[model samples]
Target: MRVKITKTNLWEVALALKILHFADLHLDTSFARIGFSSTVARFYREQLREALKRILKLAQDEKVDLITCGGDLYEHERYTSDTGKFLQGQFENIERIPVLLVPGNHDPYLPDSLYRRLFWPSNVKIVTNAELMPVWNLGEVTIWAFAHLSPTQREAPLNEFKLSDDEGNIHLLLMHASDMSSVPPGKPVHCPFKPEEIHRAGFQFALLGHYHQGRLSSLQASSVNVQESISAPGYGYPGTPEPLGFDESGHHGVIVLEIGDGKVKAELRPISQFAFVETELDISTATSRDDIKSQLQYWADEARGNYAFARAVLKGQLQPEIELDLTVLREAIGSYFRYFDLQNRTYPAYDFSELAEEKTVRGAFVREMLNRIKLATGEEKETLRSALTLGLQAFEKREILEQV
Candidate 1:
């Protein structure tokens, strides 16, 4: 797939140019706002939409030459006309900047896809075909992209590409694909490619989509011929532009790539309106609800990197006499953040070494439990340990009912 250009380099920047690349938005008006009342749902929907607006405006603010969306632009199954209009309207407002897009598994280009129905803005360019297509050439930059026509794609588009650096133009591949070597178990294996196949194909930057976590193939940046000072062999996933759930965490943002002047550099610009943060809080030393409240408040406030969706893990060994009323604690602190979940993983601080030496029934029970635990693996170990703790606590008149 080759695209021939007639226009002189569209961007007149001196060797350095910025391309804002992002993917896996999975925009759904129904999702991220489920189970709320109509009015409340609209409020939550607006929050997500507002984040998209900020991302679209970023291209103009950064003065980027091209805005590439790797894929999953919308939730295909749940897409509404309002969302289609909102997305296309935003593209219209992008002014004269170029917007390139491909469809991901969640938003594949089926016969009835929004890509086929809607009239996109003049600046928008999307590869709706299932094959490898290099349809755009802006003088110095060329883009080869394809869409996921179906959920199960066995074709390897990367294999069809053959690199020709003899022409000396910046070549980019925009598609939603899986790096088959390390794709996690059970993840939809769509448009898979082996790293060696990608390296052999020879595209400088492959802006891939689908996976929600950002990563670069090790081979993407390491292939160097001493003859060329700077190389474009590096490819990276920009991850989900805005984190959707607790599983999607850390710096949620877009990547700004500078691909000229004998070196290739990329910077992550975090522009999401919400960040998902899972905090592991050590509550072993927590003596009371007030203590837990103080720590929760501190982290809950900090988690609003914009607005936080937080899961606080209460862990470590708890003091024998102290009891944490989790329902009360959640009611008191849940309102501190946009989305909150509290997990009780704290264990009782038992003097096991001292108890192991005693000849009493409790000591015998502890020893028997310890012996069984040593032979167990996985969740079985944890279950047996909890059973022993609960059995002893019941014998000692320490049932957890009164605290709730």
Candidate 2:
């Protein structure tokens, strides 16, 4: 039987549900982009499993009423039978608490999907439909979820989705969707939807996934209004439980949602054991490779280098005769961090004013490149700068091994 809940009588009955929401776990990921060795990659994959274990432990300790995984629980292409068993075992440990999963693009609900091939715990509910389907009705709360039938699902799940007014339960949405308003660069759109569409569909809260940056959107009280309360219904992206790439650098974790006392409160609980750090080092004043190494060491120490997977970009005006060997630098100081990647963005410190006056081919090249750089913008300017550096190296008969 469906029970109706209204704001007028919200306080008359007890209404409390504690939920642990997480997404984008991406277990068994290749970690190829980070350029980690095979051994290191395996270690990171184990870390992801550890993260899931910690999340489950937290849920059991906190006694959450429910647990929702937004999606991308594992990479479908890399998932193995062992991983399937591990997942089943973990979920079974939290057998008392109901667990819901909405599959994302990386782990879609295909015929060969693990969701279909393997038997999950009775308490684990996997959404199998491409459209929004009502999966659970917990008296005062109703959860509607969906799954990505394909890896390239481009349909907007909430386009015309609307719940009937008669269903007075606190409607909630669980899915792997891209919030169109806050998509990062280079991220492909999958199951896109506007934030307003969620509330318009009468859903009190949306537990979302796909984005790797944790975010919570809720109403805020302002001084101008003075009377408005800050506890309006909203949606959130719990992001990835662990840092997947350098682009995902900020706090990555799960969202704890407590619904009671006529209000909903969301809090972020960080559970990532590793950090991805990206920073730039100015090598302008360095005279030798040792000097560059010293600067890198200093930057690493300052940034808490030992605990992070770091990418260092070396940028500055370097002496024309001094060529930086990125491979060598990485070999020298890579041990300082768990993982290290070095990029060279330095330009030759040429006296362009003096070179432009010379009658040599090198001088002519520098002047032309500088003029083009002045007229160019964005990536084009950087391209011209690189060309100039390479041209200078060719004229000097030096080995052009490093990227400028």
Candidate 3:
């Protein structure tokens, strides 16, 4: 993921340097996009292309000497050859400045892989080994990086790295790793390390990649080491150079870092031309189709973001005669936003009084159900109501329980 930067403050007296820090650019193949339905697939491609173009232009405008990418450059190992060729062309645009990358879990280095086999530009350096590889140096500043290409995903206690003198030199540590707690529940468990340990490794700044959402500041635990002077700069996750899915929304871009004479400044640049907006709407007052339509219209109008792909959670009580048409609502939102998910959470308007007085089979069933609900404990009643609600949904094609 390469973090993008448009501008930064310049140091007046000292020799200062600017670097564009980005990471977790999982460039998936067009084939994978096709699996997401045709419209969705095309949307993904557009975001990816726009993000790449933005970062390349940002680098040139910032006059960055080095573009440091944390890791996860590709989505997976199965991208088409044309994808590699396209990346090669993009790399050529910034061939004047060195682009340093460390492989992340998603785009791990494999034997005979396209990343390893392809002929990259001379300015690009792929750090595949685990040892500290000193690559970039200009005017006494050194970029010490460790590429985690080991079979296992996690690296910690960055013991191999010993910062050079703090005088006149900016020591930056670069790698791809996720904080232990941030790993998604079911995803493949990649390398996880404590941020505190990495910070205390004596480096002035520890620029990281892997976790998608951008993170800027953190503190090192006292247990790691006491020798380092400054707390590490936990830069930002470049996110995906593009948005992969609905969850992958909000400020999708890179970070630009300015390090000069022991002082560092970090800024976030948003490249996602499209916005993924997820909002909740209470349909408690909506009685007819037109009422719901007006509410939807207001929501679409209220969508205030760069690009909108919103999902409105429609909740509350629904009228007995009213039935929602999901297809119509999905269409009504239109291409103003790429996608809008109208989730129905409303309960049916059931008249309990009418059923209580009857003696028929259906009436008896309703009476007994009500009696049990009134007599049972709160926990027991809630559990039973859940079962009945699901059963009713199966029978009526909509919710029946009243949510309070």
Candidate 1: where is the Cα deviation over 4 Å? 1-18, 29-45, 164-169, 180-188, 194-196, 215-232, 257-266, 285-306, 348-404
Report the lDDT tens digits of candidate 1 across residue range 79-107. 89988899888989986888888888888
Off by over 4 Å in 2: 1-12, 219-231, 351-401
Global lDDT of each candidate: 0.72, 0.83, 0.65
Show the colliding residue pairs in model 2: none
TM-score for every candidate vs. truth? 0.73, 0.86, 0.76
Which candidate comes out best when scored by lDDT? Answer: 2
Each candidate's number of clashing pairs is 2, 0, 13
Supply the TM-score for candidate 2.
Answer: 0.86
Ranking by lDDT: 2, 1, 3
Return the lDDT, model 2, position 221.
20
